[model samples]
Target: MDLRVAAAVSLLLALATTTGAVTFNATNTATGTIGGLRFDVAVGLDYANLVLSNASAFIWSSAFNQTRPADRKPVDAVTLVVAADVSGAAAFTAADVITLSAPYVGNYSGDVRTEVTGVLFHETTHVWQWDGQGHANGGLVEGVADFVRLKAGYAPAHWVKPGQGDRWDQGYDVTARFLDYCDSLKPGFVALLNAKMEDGYTDDFFAGILGKGVQQLWQDYKANYDA
Candidate 1:
């Protein structure tokens, strides 16, 4: 018998072949154009489609999809991994994630509709956001994501309160509110901050925007809010 065949026969005959294990790698298949970006979706996957589709829309709307000096591509090839149920919850990692709601057969509308669009606006910001080469503030990271959601016109209705949070970067809705306030003081403030973050992030960048350190700016923000 051939050496390979002999080895296989020995293994099959030994111990009645009781114990064994096998692993599978998921294959991704690309579908139709998603907001002008093509994607190879993972089979039997749910959330990745939702998130990547929304990111495509935001980039197109924001004009990031257009050719620019940055040479950033509208949609980076996405890798989808389903880990735990992330619906109605926050992501703990830097990777972009989405959890599917009931599949809407027709056009997306209403609250859940907006939440899908909004969360991706928030999450995909993580995908593209620069973090001072991994040295950015945690609060600022959360704030920037929420800020993108805010700008996307998908902020939750209850998110209108300007300033009532404990800290400046309380994350999510709270930090979003503070960013809105900062924008009121300086038009294009968030845009400027985002541009700065593209290169680096620090409290000094906040000072460049507000004429003071972020801590002092937070103090002023609180005083104004309290007034």
Candidate 2:
């Protein structure tokens, strides 16, 4: 074998050994009613794997600070299910599967394509983000997910503006805004905070990272906007 060819093969083998496998599937259970929406989400599905991969990379870059695949979640596959049965929620992710509401797809008044992409980006983050070993504040967990959405340029027009939330851990867009503020104070603040939460969660993580209590940070955040 040629020396260069042997080296190329060796590199390929090494990459195959180190890289993780990720799969994505999008299914529409509300086929009949979905009509054109089905086509839109199907298009979204076509890019689901790419979206998941990109979202994972973004999540790690934004919060986890884990550049290597080995440092992130060991999820092997993610499935997006669009169902009409889910009511009162646009979407929810459990484990590695994201279930989107088909009714939401059917009734969405605005840009369904972009909206679904945003929802997918948000839900996909849930599949990759740490949950403080299930001890973290639920609001913070949700906030991190929305923060991913925010960074992806998928933030909807209705989302609360920065420094507009009532509390730091208020969850969703509110907490996302607060987390963004925290991240602004120091680069990669979310990433370090997430790394600390890998084992478990503590309020001290805030003071340790930003030199201020979480409540104090919230107060400062609010004061910045005179809110």
Clash count of each predicted structure: 0, 1
Candidate 2 yields a Cα-based lDDT of 0.77
Please list the residue runs of candidate 1 whose C-alpha ends up more than 4 Å from where it truly belongs after superposition. Answer: 1-75, 79-110
lDDT of 1 by residue, 1-227 (tens): 01122232343323222322111121222222231121122223344454444443443334233223233323334343333333345333344333332222121244443454465567667665556665777887788778777766667777747767888878878787788788878877776676677567677888888788777777787898783
Q: Model 2, residue 184: displacement in angstroms?
A: 0.5
Window of ten residues with lowest summed lDDT in model 1: 35-44
* Residue 120 lDDT (model 1): 53
lDDT of candidate 1 at residue 116, scale 0 to 100: 49
List the lowest-lDDT window of 10 residues for candidate 2.
1-10
User: Can you tell me which runs of candidate 2 are displaced by over 4 Å?
Assistant: 1-18, 35-44
What does candidate 2's lDDT look like per residue over 20-136, in tens digits?
A: 576667776667676336635444556555555566555655556776777877888888887778889889999998988887877788877677778877898889888889999
Best by TM-score: 2
